[model samples]
Target: MPQPESQNQPIAGRYELLEEIDHGGMGSVWRGYDAVLDRPVAVKLIRQQSVTSPELAEEFVKRFKREARITARIQHPGVPQVYDAVLDESYEQLFLVMELVDGISLRSYVQPTQLLPVSWAAAVTAQVATVLSHAHAVPVIHRDLKPGNILISHDGTVKVLDFGIAAILRSDVTKLTATGTPLGTHQYMAPEQVRGGRTSPQTDLYALGCILHELLSGRLLFTADSEYMVMYQHVNAAPTPLRQLRPDVPTALEDLVLHLLRKAPEARPADVQEVYERLEPFLPSPGAQVSAPGQAGPAGVPDPTSIFRKPYAPRARAGQQSAAGQAAESATAQPAPPVPDAVRAAIKVAYSRSDALLEDDRFAQAAEVIGEVIEPAALALGSESRQVLELRMNRAAIWLLGGDYRAALPELDALSDAYARTSGPSSERARACRAQAARCRAELGQVTDALAALRDVLDVVRSVDGDVSEEAVELRRDIGMLFLAQGRTTEAHNILEPLHADLCLVLGPDDEMTSEIAEVLAVIRLDLDGPPS
Candidate 1:
């Protein structure tokens, strides 16, 4: 199969493939950028290995497009929005563009040393059940519902992935294997599924039971050396009670798992709703304390129960102040002896190298070039020397350009404070730094604070330079785009409509800035009002 030749190459002339997210037997996924949409997206590229002949190829394309369309029909927050599906002209590759979900998978939460708390397990299972209910209602059976296929997003929303993908991939696998073995997750497969029987909502329930059991027991429900052995266990073996492994497990909860693991599809819970109901007793109620000692997952893992505890809560802002930011706040920059000639020359060389690297779109390497001289330069000319601070700012900018927002955010925050300390808060350097930090915040998904920061900067800009000035225009445009990102379309349209008119008046309708704003306004108008009659 043909692979992407360049790391930064745009796929099909629109989706710029940045970094590889993951790879599997089928193909790989990329953290891609949509040039047209100006947003980050997850792109799954399907390889052509399954299509052995032209006839199979044509059918593959038809089935792939149909599955993509049906997957998009699942209108739930738990389902990542499918933005587009692109089949390459050569039929060599297919791309599924989807909303980028930033979260730890349940696989990460499964640790033999620390099984999840009862509430945590229940919270995750309940959320998945809710998502399953939505998918099944659309008559979409997730033929392969496994822990890896589920994601707990940062905001604690449980997202189900690849709804129609299993059905498509199963056919491909069966054709290749020519073995009659069923093609679902062996550990989570229902007895009927193991027998190559028809799957339904009950199959999904069986998978959910497997997930819940693993979450509570920190082990697969059935384990063996080979896929065939695991499949056989699913069909014939009886599962051990959860309490036997973890006596703290409630008897009722254990019973629920046994009921779900029943060999027959008809013997399982009636539907996902029933599974959700059974899980409710172990879930944290609204406003209830979500954690107890030993209840937390691995450090840095988000609390899934936060959704029920504070339903519909805005994403908790990223760390307001990293440790370095705090130190920068408490310690003042002290003047030191003049820098030596050799150190200054090294700093200059580093800057030249970084500038060249950046020109070639080698952002990470560019940041590294700057980083190499920062410590030596700081040692020779005080830590907060103009030369050292300049290097820090440039590196941080490179990180932001590279889409390393987490690395850029804290540095930008500290840079803003440092600039304000040296130059007054209203000075050009300080305001500019603050504005850049706000942009970092926006990219990091702290929309509320980011919007507030940008507005503050805009107010300062308008007071000095009029609202139509270059900086003011850019800030206004950014605020409108931010609002649009948050799904406040009417507000976004209200902000951008007048802004577009102003851009046209000042820069003319054909100007690049004016045209970009006009394009966004066109999209917003289309969303607010239906398509033309």
Candidate 2:
């Protein structure tokens, strides 16, 4: 075994590495500070604990450097900005200084809070989407976003903690596959990704769906007590309904969450922004607002056009072996139907310990452990308790990751209702339900209805949460994405750029949002600047 290095030692004379904060297959994080800047910072030291060969170690350092450089390019309100990356003496280690987030992982939050009220769960997810959008904007994909990587501050500020597995979508493809790193979380992997296929914005969307499910349920979405079982489930099993577990969930919103849980990548929403937009309405208060009696002129049926654009299923890649691969894959890999009581209970217990399996990137193990818990728990425990609501959310999220969006919807709706009662109309819980509902509608080609649903919350959201928080920024970003998807390039640009600019100013140039907005702009350029108007 490699001996642990002494805490509080100086590395490169620039950063004082304090206590060990965390360790991954890639590196160890430490509570450290910059001697020059004087502000405390967290330093992640890339592990050189073992190398199959000394030659590989040299190659490892180079790969790590290349990866670090790509990470440094990211900027987002919800992602830690890396300030420095360097090699230590004898070039034994590589360390990166990142903004220290003063809170626990989302995992910790779920355990103690267990089944966060719906709005709050949506809030966490929205912030995550904000981070993802930004990361993807650099055209970089956070191939490994999970609960542990999501950090929430004491005051509720959130940041995504690692860039280790971030994949740059640039021409530098050589760097990613060079060391043959088997990147990403298994349970959260999109169907295309799971099949060792192409990746796009939709890949991250699948992961977020899983993460969102976990946060809402305090549970994992897939399980069978083994990695293979979990991977098999992700590839083949259908998820249990979220509402059946959480009886209080609203039907409309739950429908949306399940849509994200679809089994085929092409069946899932085209991008993460779509998820955010769909979910935003449910994030607001549930009580409908009456337009103050006889209020003003021209109050025709609400403009359904504003909230959503059509959400066609994502087209399979051009060179894909079959143009109807999505249909064929779905037909061939139909998921396992919900099983009996005995089987369900066993699965739930297995899925609850996902964190234990995360280190080895045995995401399949973690997922299986988590997924198995859902069905049995719903059977053994009444669906109305806090526990059930939590389980439902998790199951729905897994369904989302599996590309079983239809299955996830019911759970999201159920969660919204429970949160409405638990946290009340004014809280973030209520808002999550509204937002998630919108996301589902948008994904299902109910763009008009999706926007309308989102519009339904505008009044309540504005009243309760008010404008200008990160939550508000995320909502705006969602709308921007909706516009872009519909080819309303100018409209999308106008809404997103200013918000993007604001994120840059408040969070700095390296924030995740900075990259997300830029990426959106890049897409707009390709879609609008070079195409038929």
What are the RMSD figures for all models against the true structure?
A: 10.5, 23.8
**Model 1 lDDT per residue over 342-367, tens place:** 78998889999888967767676678
Worst 10 residues of 2 by lDDT: 296-305
As for model 2, its CA RMSD to the true structure in angstroms is 23.8
User: Can you give the lDDT of residue 104 in candidate 1?
Assistant: 62
Local error of candidate 1 at 470, Å?
14
Give the poorly placed runs of model 1, Cα more than 4 Å off: 5-9, 166-181, 291-294, 318-413, 420-428, 431-533
Q: Determine which window of 10 residues in candidate 1 has minimal summed lDDT.
A: 168-177
Evaluate all candidate structures by whole-model CA lDDT and list the values in order.
Answer: 0.80, 0.64
Candidate with best TM-score: 1
Candidate 1 residue-wise lDDT at 335: 42
